[model samples]
Target chain A: MDSVVFEGIGKRYRSLWALRGVDAAFRQGEVVMVIGPNGSGKTTLIKCLLGLVRPSEGTVRVNGQLVGSDPAYRQRIGYMPQISQFPPALTIGQLLEMMRDIRGLDAETVDDTLVGALGLDRQLEKRLSTLSGGTCQKVSAVLAFRSRPSILVMDEPTAGLDPLSARTVLDQAAALRSNGGTVLITSHLLEEVETLADRVAYIEDGRLRFLLPVKEILQRSGATRLAQALPVMLSNSATP
Target chain B: MTKVYKYTLVDLARNRFVLAFAVLMLVLAEGLFRIEGDAMKAMLSLVQVTLALVPLVTLVFTIVYSYDTQEFTQLLAVQPIRRSAILAGRLAAIATAVLMALAFGLGLPLLVHLPGMVSLLLFAANALLVLVFVALGTLLALTQRDKARGVGIGLVTWFLFVLVYDALLMALMFALSDRPIEPWVVPLAALNPIDLARIAVMLRVDLAAMMGYSGAVYQRFFGSAQGILLALGLMVLWAAWPALVAFRVFRRKDL
Candidate 1:
């Protein structure tokens, strides 16, 4: 079953159309990496799915329910925004406690694996403002995954992480995909997507250029690596 | 809503700026009381200071806090909560923090020195003023996307409320002093929370002679219990209108 669907989504900010007629669907268990250059509306597409940006047209469906109709559906979605914006005054521990309190999730149901994996447990007492950009990103990751969400939406999840931390995130995404959880991510790292994404969503100039499986992309372009295959595939697809 | 409010309050409690504001108020109030050596005189001095200072502080602080929490607001927006809860919670937390600062800084001084009905009314008036400005600040923050512009607008709003509005009203009154405009001008006070608060406390303080023409009219018109209630009701309306509009804007706004 399709766990998430965006039907002809369109978003306009003042004069610029950030997204126009974007349509796609993610299966119950798949990792789809959204690929686009800067200012290509990749984040806007993800925001529309998260209901952070209301689509000027069309609708988003999560678990077969309309996105804006109810917020309860978000309980199943774990989102890590590209920029970490937790309260600056809060310690990492306090922020975690606050999220748990907001969700009303008890101790037994809460997942703290990322807390240990991200090394956030040791730095729990550090205020968000005091943490470096990389550490803050890890905190965002821990919060995103801690809820044990069925549908995960991570926007450039590994943008600021070190290689080791980035690997842990990828492993977590892979583990979640294997457990039948859907993961939607956007990253500039095509190599990471090579091993992680089941499918690739290439968005450019505020439009979805293509949505194809990874194996098909490699096969169609006749390139072994995604880095070389994507350009060839886009040019080939653009021509025909 | 309570969850948002609780966490926001927790975040605010950790803020040193708010603590400094409280301390500043305490020092000012205590200083005035010590110099005057009389509770009533000290309160009169404090009233003038707060009339200008409280709104300015609340507006600036609220605007900065709202802008700083943009990321936090975005984070909460994707959660399983209504937009209204997020807005109301943050607004309530700002109000609570400012009110606590006022209560400790000013209210405690009043309770220690005056300890009477007039002082209590003064505290209530200050509290209402805080709410009104916080509402205005929230509206300003939500409307203006740029932080510098928002803070600039906030300062202008404080100026208009604390100084410009009264100046315009007084100028109009003096220009129209020949006509029977005093009665009509009484309602105009309701348009400004600062004016309403000033009139409300002045009446209780029994300062009709000091009250200008409009204030005298307010005293005469709303001198009774029903009149005081009516003024407070108007202040509450002032406190709520901007916040309600801000909430509506937030509902459809792209975070």
Candidate 2:
């Protein structure tokens, strides 16, 4: 079953089209990478899927239910926002504990797994505001991944991570897909997407321009590097 | 509903600054009561100020907190919990926190001066005011979506209630000096929550004389059982309107 479905979804801010008639879907266990230049509605598309922005036209659904009709739809998904701010005084441990409590999950086991996965046991007591950007991203990643949500919607998830942390997160994403979880990730790191994504969906000017298998993209662009392939893909599909 | 309420209470309790502020307000209230020999008079004045100002301040706090916690709210929205539950949780948390603060600020003063019915009335009035303001604040915060603008609007509304509303009433009275104070005018005072609270408490203390002509008018009309009932109804409306408006906005909002 498709974990996400969008049919003719569009969002407008005043006179500007943030997104226009975007049709897409992601099935369970698939890793879909969304790539676009700035103002190409990459973030807008994600927001609409997450029910953060109501599409002015068409429908958005998660697991076949309308986005607005059911709040429970959110529980099945984990979202990592591009820019997230934590309460200034909360420690990493406190943050995790609070989310767990709010979600009504047992803290002991989840805390143990989170600490092991992120190697954050040492920084558990450190205040969120004091943490570096990379550390904060790690905390966010843990929060998104902790519950083992069925669907993960991450925006720029690996932006600030150190190389090792980035690799760990990517590995986790792969593992999640293997376990039948759906992952929809957006990032400027084309090389990372090339390494992890099973399918790539390129959007331009608020409209979806390309949806192709990763291998197909690599073959068509005739480039061994994703960095080399990205320009080729964009230039070929520059027209709306 | 209980989970939302419980979470709100817990979050409010964890905020050190708010807790400290509540403590400070309680101390001030206690000191003021001790300094003033007439307990009823002191309590009445203090309740007036608290009802008008605390709600406004609480509203500002709610807006700032909401803006600061935007990411948290986004995460919460994705949770399986209902959107209404999320909003209710935040509102309940803020209202409970502010109510605690108001209790500390006004509770001691009432206890020191008029410890029984007067204290209870003051507490009830304070609670109503807190709910009304929190609801108002949430609506304003959701509507404005900007911390500075929301806070500014909250402060202006506070000023109007705490100072300008009464001043305008007095000016109106002065302007109508030539006409007799009508029975209907007494009910108009109920339009302002602060005014109705003042009337209710002052009537209890037998200090209606302090209000001059307005006092006389109130005694002649709403001074009886029906008048009190009407005043209470108006107060309920004051608290209800903002809450309903806020709930409507939150239900439709993207985040």
Candidate 3:
């Protein structure tokens, strides 16, 4: 069974169909990248898979269980939203501690890992309001990666990170996949996706335009860079 | 379920806003009791502020909290926990936090006066109000989705409860002055939670002279076993209606 599956999944919001007939499966130890332009239903797909938004048609299953039926499916998955809002009053340490407490994970080891990797030990006491955008993004990254759940779903995970922070996140994603974890990530940055993804799923206007192995896509497009190859694929798909 | 509740309580306790509000309530209640010189008046005043105003404030706060934590909620949704359990955990955390604040705010004053059965009754009344309003606020938040709109609806509902409902009732009474509808108005008066709270407390103080004609009217009809039961039922309904609506909406919502 696949680690995550979307079979004929569709989501309708009023008159707008945010996603239509999305069919895909993600396997353990695979790093899949979902790429699309803004308003192309990337977030909607993620939300549907997470069971935050119910699909209007078809089913979304994770690890052979329907997401809607089992709430604990989320416990096996770690999600980093595109934009996170932390309570201004809470210190970085306090926020991380709260998340750990909510998930019922031990604090000592997780805290140590977070401090060492993210260099958050010195900034632990600083309130979230006092942190810069990049710093806040670092905190979010630490929280998402700390639990090391079997399945990781991150939306625009590296949006505001410094180059080093971004590299650390990418390395972590690669490590998780090497450990037989399923990692699904979405981003507008083509380079990150090209480097980290084993499979690429391209979406346009709420429809799946293409899904193929990263190497196949790169070879077929005959473009040296994913940034160049993406446009060719989109233009070709746009005609039909 | 127990684990969820425990974790929820911990989360609520750690929230800085809840902590600050709880402390502020206690301080205010203490100050009111010291200045009032009358125990009943102090209690009455505290109930008005705590049950009426605090719940409204807390309800709006909860709505905003839920909206602001959309990402967090999304993260939790992918977990092994049931969606209902997640919502229940959140609701339980919010309800317990609000109740604790109410208790500390009003409980301190009651302790000073050494309230009897009357205190328990007041507490029950206040609890009903809090539950009803929180549920209403949740439903409003779910329905509106927008933070500003939800807060606006909450404020309007508060105004209706605190001001408009009574104003409308008074207008109706004046319009019906010629019909001698005093007997029929007794049941209608029981419909309002604010009125019920006022009557419950006033009855404890002195139903005979303090309530005047309204007191006699209450005693004549609702003063009976069945009438009192009916009044209590209305209060329960007030608490139940919004909660039931919220639960149903939440169950189906694509949050």
Candidate 4:
């Protein structure tokens, strides 16, 4: 199966360690929710995978190719950052055109299915800064999924999104996962995680604390649901 | 890479500040022409603006613009584009934008007035000014994160080049007045892009009239076609040096 392998990944910024000797894999055709508290190296891990931030130690491989050595590897993975900030003056149309141009794809060849679903056609003329947070998140969604990448790494995908738009975004991501694509999502919203994540990787203090299926997490915690089980698991892990 | 350049150029070319700059240049150049009634005199005034305002505007504008495009850079960074391409493309975009503004701004008025060589040399000098400053701005922006401090350094850089450096040269000239400082003055001045461009123009137009003894010294070394070629070559080197530095920083930078 296709997988992104993190082999003893370590990242250090001066004296502070962001990720330490961590080994993990985001395997294909599954929605893997990476859950962690704030500043738990979640963003750092994502950046390392994208090759935006170089790792202090170890290597990251996407489909067995080093992410750093291969720019083409990035084409297979679509990434959506936590914040959906773009150039303030740029219109959505212009941005999409630039993206399409950069991707070396023609209009007819490009798949902007998410754009149509989100009703972004009317808002295409609007400047980026004018959009509400939810709408901006939607634009980010389109950019991520429109390219039809095999893997999607979304950092806090629906943080500022409205319930309805968030549903659309989640549904689009889920659709991508069901179509033999791998998805890696990080979010504080456990309810969404429960609905979407097939397996959850609990990260804390720059290490993968626990990784288990949602059902197993619930069963082991002696709780009926993942929401209730998460606290129990956290307490047990802390004691251990 | 070409795609990045195309969009960056187009996007920046249509920016309001670029348009405003162009309009302001037209107004200033035309007004100077009307007031002085001599194209040569008007060009001298324009040269001062080019030396002072061009560097500051290009440096500050490029730095601020670089910070503004951070998000866009992120968007591109995740793509199949190389980091060097991303940095170089953006730098080229900004240089192209600023050059276009200066061209249209000054070109609208002075194109019809100045002699062909003088007009072309003037434009070349200004273009080099834009390239050099933008490259420096790129390096500064890559190294420094704080916008206020970055902008502050940019302002100080302008002040150093436009005012302080010249003042220091004047002091050096005074101290070594009897020591054949003539040789040192021109060589030292060549280090600054502004000084190099200023000499390039002064040699072409009126060197002896405006510059007194120092002018004669410069005219002797930089008076010939070979000297002019060398000066222009140095100006190109000035642009290339900072651009190379920025590219190196950009490649190693963590987004």
lDDT digits (tens) for residues A1-240 of candidate 3? 479999998899999998999999999999999988899988899888887788899998889988676566676777777777675666787777767766678865453454568788889889787888888877877877777788898889889988888888888889999999999999888886678899888888899888888887778789888888888877777321
| Candidate with better TM-score, 3 vs 4 | 4
* Candidate that scores best on TM-score: 1
Q: Give the best candidate by lDDT.
A: 1
At residue A37, give the lDDT of candidate 2: 85
Q: Best DockQ goes to which candidate?
A: 1
Summarize candidate 2's per-residue lDDT along B1-255 as a digit string, tens digits.
Answer: 566566546656767757776876777677667777777666766766666656666767777777777777777776677777888888888888877777666775566567797678667777777777778888888888778998899888878777798898888888987887574466568767778877776766667788888888877666776776676667889988888888888777866
Please give, for residues B60-178, the per-residue lDDT of candidate 4 as tens digits: 99888888788778878899878888877888888888888898888767777775787787888888888889999988988898888998999998899999998998888888888
lDDT by candidate, in order shown: 0.89, 0.78, 0.76, 0.83
User: Which pairs clash in model 1?
Assistant: none
DockQ ranking from best candidate downward: 1, 4, 2, 3
Taking all chains together, the TM-score of candidate 4 against the true structure is: 0.95
Better of 1 and 3 by lDDT: 1
DockQ each: 0.77, 0.53, 0.44, 0.61
Total clashes in model 1, counting residue pairs 3 or more apart in sequence or in different chains: 0
Q: Which regions in candidate 1 have their CA more than 4 angstroms from the true location?
A: A237-240
DockQ of 2: 0.53
